[model samples]
Target: MVDPDDVQFIDEMPHTATGKIQKTALRDMFADYAFPA
Candidate 1:
């Protein structure tokens, strides 16, 4: 789970030509998820 308030919104998600998130994927990959407060 993640905190709704802490959830960061981005205008565009970085991805390769394959439609897979590239740069943004790393952020999510190593992100520390926590339950919503």
Candidate 2:
């Protein structure tokens, strides 16, 4: 199970003009996420 506090919620997934999921953008958004020690 994951901790609720550590989860990041987004209004929607970022997409490209062609309607593809923007994986790079998604990764960058959570790049600063910190895990429990």
Candidate of highest TM-score: 2
TM-score of 1: 0.43
lDDT of 2 by residue, 1-37 (tens): 9646666679999999999999999999988888777
Q: lDDT of all the models against the reference? A: 0.72, 0.89
* Alpha-carbon RMSD, each predicted model: 5.4, 3.1
Q: How accurate locally is residue 14 in candidate 2, as Cα lDDT from 0 to 100?
A: 98
Work out the TM-score per prediction.
0.43, 0.66
Model 1 lDDT tens row, 1-37: 8645666567777889998879778677648866467
Which pairs clash in model 2? none
Give the winner by lDDT.
2
Q: Compared to the true structure, candidate 2 yields what TM-score?
A: 0.66
